[model samples]
Target: MSQSTDFDLTSSQTAEFDLTTVAFKSNPYPILARLRTHDPVYQYTSSPDGQSTWLITRYEDAEIVLRDERFVKDKQSTLPPEERAPSAGPAPSVSDLFDLGMLKFDPPDHTRLRKVVNLFFTPRATEQWRESVQRISDELIDKVESQKRMDLIEDFASVLPIRIISEMLGVPAEDSMQLHLWTKRIADALDDPAAFEQVASDLQAFYTYLLALVEKKRQASTDDLVCKLMHASVEGDQLTERELVAMIFLLILAGHETTTNLIGNGILALLTHPEQKQLLQAQPELIKPAIEEFLRYLAPFTITTHRWAREDVEMRGKLIRHGDAVLVSLAATNRDENKFDHPDTLDITRQENPHIAFGKGVHYCLGAPLARLEGQIAINTLLRRLPAMQLDIEPEALVWRTGSTVLGVNHLPVTF
Candidate 1:
């Protein structure tokens, strides 16, 4: 990535480049491209709180931030004593619920939490679910096969992962829809900070459900990931009640949400790029690499969760002060001209692809293998079963979900 000695943020550009707006979420590439070229380390101030966050756009800079130890995930540890005081509130905020997960921790603690369930998500272990994933995909398609038309996201993409993860976590089949609703609201809150209060009730209900589930597991163990975690330990250190609840919460939300986007975005890519779609149909062997292409061309998580500067740091001549929020744009880094040739083009058969859609470094997504398995089976089964599948609505008429953290369509209607 080329270094930019001068930073330029015109008043007009600043006004138009607001990241929180629906329009920006719908299409952030053009603006991200401009930032990558001019201000690789741009500072964006939130309109509501006026808190500034440094945005890392270029591939080189993004890699540095992701891998560097100085950019920590736990901001509470680095904040000054005065700023660290807990805010008085009637109930815990949605952000508080999120901070309990492993995603919000650094090594040692993060390592310990991940180690308890790491065996379940390994590449080899994930293969065990291939048949289960295929069966679920077939069953989902069977329901809509005769309908001739269906909302792909609602009827398929979203359902497949939730069912799989629910089963893995030993959650009852009947409760899948309820869990889905809760996770969706939590994701929406993460996307739009303003929606936190609106979704607090749902979040609390979800938390209560998890508490009950944990207690039930304690009395009776089963051969499921959740049960295994309840007994599994590293160096004879077992997970506490709070740790267990947070672990299960993270697994449920991250497991299905990211894969849902993977399947949704992957199918959308194929629908728009006819040639690539045809190529994959003709050569089924390309499904694995095609999934990688989808992750690259349209990353599931556009920008990473906030990482705070442990201390004053300089990158590309920009100063990121201690305790300041830093975010790495995975979407921009994947499309960096310096890394991938013709970065915007969708090429399923491309031989040289190294995208960080699941992210990189210590915090790399643990459910990536499962997500790839689900995407491969879901996309391939859809193509094989409904060979004539096509978008039911005009491409431009589709509405994108608010917020840039996760990239996906709200609903994908399709016809066979």
Candidate 2:
């Protein structure tokens, strides 16, 4: 790793950089760069809960933590008996509903849960949805084309993936907005603890809705993905009722959120770099590589979901004790000076790209192929149809959505 004398953050200086701040969320690259350089394994403490989490910033160290089996996802399993006591009340918190999926498990359980739906998300299977994705992208643009000005996020980026995923999961198109609202609330609660009480009703409503949907699928013989999951059995083991709800919940949230941000962020990147946009327009075949570049330049997922240390482990010069939470900054790692040349530059034609935007190891995103397909189709369709499209507001004036795991603008106002 090369050392730079330009900027350095001492341990004390690092503590001042809160990850949850709106400023950090809007532009985290500068802070993350300093962390990677001065403190690769930096420790961050949340002011709300007084819980400490180790932030792994460098590319190599982040990869190590991701691939290392010692660093697990199930924090409960690693907790001491005293810390694992059951709650006195039965009220469900955001974690109760959101963390029950495969993303929160490890080993046999994660493997089993993932295997049940693995085939549905493979590259070949995802290719079958290209026509549907193209149709949805076109329809979304067609609605706004006549208007000449539209919030790209509200009208197009956020709607396309939800529609496709809803159709695949047999969820009614009418329920997409409600589901999106519930998912956003859940994510907000996770990001800001104080918001939990306000969104509790939403959490319960979402859970109840999914439960009813599962039972509905159970009674009828449908051909959607939900029906297939209901009947899918791996090694004579079927998904339990809770598991089914959790799986469906995970699919709905993960299915659209990442892809939504990808389209939004990718468009913004191209709009800011007009040359790259023109490059893609001149050679439409560059869409695939351009999508990859967008992901590398600005990953939709800024940091990974928390991973817990099962036992005391050391990375770099810092020690992460047992039961400690660790977060790998995918956004930071993608821009590591050692990983990619001109890491900060937006180069659509660059070839040596190896980004872990969807994550790595066993927990690598299952819907990556689908997300890429949607991004390619969405961006290509927009450029082809709206040749004069440009950002309506200055880049700095755009408001980025906060209190969520996904990194994207709240509204991408654009005009052609």
Q: Of the candidates shown, which would achieve the greatest lDDT relative to the real structure?
A: 1
Local accuracy by lDDT, each model: 0.85, 0.84
The global Cα lDDT (0 to 1) of model 1 is 0.85
Q: How much does candidate 2 score in TM-score?
A: 0.93
Candidate 1 lDDT tens digits, 100-215: 68888898778887887788899999999999999999999999999999999999998999999999989999999899888877786674567767888898888888888988
Root-mean-square deviation (CA) per prediction: 3.0, 3.4
TM-score of each model, paired residue for residue = 0.94, 0.93
127: Cα error in model 2, Å: 1.3
lDDT digits (tens) for residues 24-101 of candidate 2: 777888878877887778776654567887878888988888989999987777987777744212553435455668
Q: Which ten residues in a row have the lowest lDDT in candidate 1?
A: 86-95
